[model samples]
Target: MSTAAVVRYWLACDFHRERRIRAVLSSFHTAGGQLQPGIVDHLAGRRINQIKPSQPNKPYSAAEWERLAQACNTMIKSANTDHRRAVEASERGMESSDASLSEERLAWIIRSSGPLAIRSLMELFPTATVETHQLVVSLRRSLFPDQDVAFAYNLLFAIRTGIVPDGIDALLTGDVTRTGPSSILLSYMKGRTGKESLVLSRAAVRVLDQWLEHSALLRGHAGDQGSQLWLGTNQRTKEGGRTIFTTPRTQYRRRVWAQRAGLIDDDGGRLQIHGGRVRATFHHLKDRSAWTGRTTIDPNHSAKVEADHYLSSHTPAQKDAIEGIIEDAQTDIRRKAAPPLVTNERDAAKFAQQFPNLVQEAELDLPAVQKLLDAEQDVFVAACASPMKSPYAPVGKLCPARPWVCLLCPLAVFTARHLPNLLGLKEYFSAQAAQLPLPQFMGVFGPYAARLDEEILPRFSTWEIAAAAGNHQTLPLTLEEQGCY
Candidate 1:
């Protein structure tokens, strides 16, 4: 694993606890020495495999291995006793509210407390699927331990569907009111919900929320990061380029519901939760994971870069803001290609002569335009709109208005491809959106979007497992990340 992969590796697991562990390690150890089995033993108890020669056909490096070590450190620490107890406590609290306790509950428990929760829940269902009678009995015994509470649930759907935080059971529970999660209401409390909190169903949102809270990010009805959802730079010229920063589907959904749930109106743009872009999220996660590919791909370098650079230090909202930028960067680029640029000096002169009066009135604008063009023949009217600059450079730097950045940006690629599908970003966005009903779209995309946050992207990433944040020692990123040294 490269530095970035190692960071993402820890993120793929218990990113929350791994954050603290990373801090500990960064503050304590400073160098990349040989594989330190003693440290691995002390942290995760997993012995390191001896370094082996790479096959002639295969190439690997020490830096990658060090990254893997950092990620492993996070996983190891998450399983540490302190983290376990914290997760267990969270599971118990969730159980207090979780209605279905058989498989659904079992899923939640196991995912949260890991093998321990599984072992405990397994005792309740000694004979596989628990009928209502068995479920009731198990529930009574499990909930009260000493006495039985008669809580009756409806007839079963699928026992396997419930329990795991991001599992189908959790999803089913989320669809209905009884198991519908109120969300892991968090406000800097740092609830340690654990990975077991992740289930496939609607409960996945709650699980993801709790997972974030566990990472020490404050969550509630509303909060803002006081940051712009864009990443772009202004060149020496008057124009500045921008890359839109978009919130993940999970965070976006949480935001929408947060308002309905009476949490907060506008997190003042700092925090936003929209539940409509899970597919895009999956693609991004896959892209990052593909880099590490440990035992699989090249050991994802991009993910590790993200983990190293923007994994934890920034507020959850800030991190999301950055990820949003990255997500946008990977998005498909689309725009009205400039009308054939003013190809020649003769055409430019003719256009000037035709608009001679308008030109005189807008001298300031003309100078800016002339400055942008290397010569009079350089400009051309494209798309029946204003004359556009060369396509080679990002549109933002070419155009001055901040909103214009969307017209020509690599980050906007995904948005460009999907905007037609989404009523929000489509042409005549407000008008088209007004003509269409939203419930159905929200239903399918809503949950998916909720599933794409850092807490869930791992499902699509290289890890072949759910990913988390905060799992590396060094701030992993290229020199350009503003927050790091």
Candidate 2:
């Protein structure tokens, strides 16, 4: 639809509650037809009943949601005023038949002088929320107190589930059922494409029950055993009679709330809360559940659509969360693998200098003279003096191989001074291996541990082994306590 038509539809529909002429007329306005019945009929002669696809909505940030909720409070305050209620009542034709609820009335106002002027204002801002004690004591309640509970629930449900305004109108009493823990069944699905049943969260179920109770108290009927869960009174209809409350009015009030909240974006896309909320819900699910490769919030969506579009558009935080999961998995694998070995002082010094971040040094001395040493809890092991490049070291970078891989490499050299670190490495790997997946445990830890136990330990002297055992019991614990764990 053209932008003008979209703007006109909300303006015209917001004022009238007629189901017959206004319903078709509202469709014409949204579909870009002239306000005149003859012109609208001419434009939609053949394709009168065709449904148009909705525009994609952008998701709101956490700040935007908070602002929207706050705005709802502001609107409630303004809605209670004599002037505001008069305007709202006139718009709904609750005033005397002689009273004017036309552009002329709005023209006298400051912000909106006419229909076009109000439309322009709305094009810039959209309103969207609720109050404590489960009610909004505003002009709406003053004018239509019977519908207050139902109206509040409509906004609450939409904010929570991202359901379209029209979808909410389709909801029935039978749709709500307690199926299981943390699950409330929603049976009256929105459209043909909607899920047969939706399992609502426990929190949602609690609110739903409250709304039902409020409805029963006000209307003097049990909402739990009725045809419609949402029942509200209205002042105007095409027939100039009372009508059932619907989404169009709810939508208009929400926009007013949003505009007051100052949550509307510059582009005016969020003026319509449904699409924006739906997008936000989708993004939240993607961030939380994408790693399992089964992130589906709205059950109506196909897997292909979810994977192709939603998963590919992860926010920066979502990307970081996914990477964190992968890192955890990789760490688990390395823990099960074998521990590295330093058989002599030369190798120990070389490994220490090559991987300074991994090895804690007591002093910064030249590697050529090999004076730097790895400090234990209260002792220092003299550095190894190996001459050749580490066999497992990566090109132009520190070693990427796991510690256990260092034990199996032929280039490895070690001595008594290296005993403490070597024992700690073995202990760390043995503890991690148990937590890793079986494939990673077998592939990395089993073979490396065997090599460290067999070939490397035999080369160490009795005194050196004793020192390593002592360092293993104390040195690693010291590093952990110092926040280097």
Best by TM-score: 2
lDDT of 2 by residue, 1-103 (tens): 4545634554455233323444676686898865655445544443223345676566666566555545543443443343344445445443334433233
Model 2 bad stretches (over 4 Å): 1-55, 70-149, 180-183, 192-195, 221-226, 235-240, 243-251, 257-272, 275-279, 282-286, 289-485
| Reference-based TM-score of each model | 0.14, 0.33
Candidate 1, residue 352: lDDT: 52
Against the true structure, whose lDDT is highest?
A: 2
Candidate 1 lDDT by residue in tens digits, 383-471 = 11223332344543454322223333211211111222222222222332354467754442333233222222222334322121222
Q: Give each prediction's root-mean-square deviation over alpha carbons.
A: 31.1, 22.3
State residue 160's C-alpha deviation in candidate 1, in Å: 17
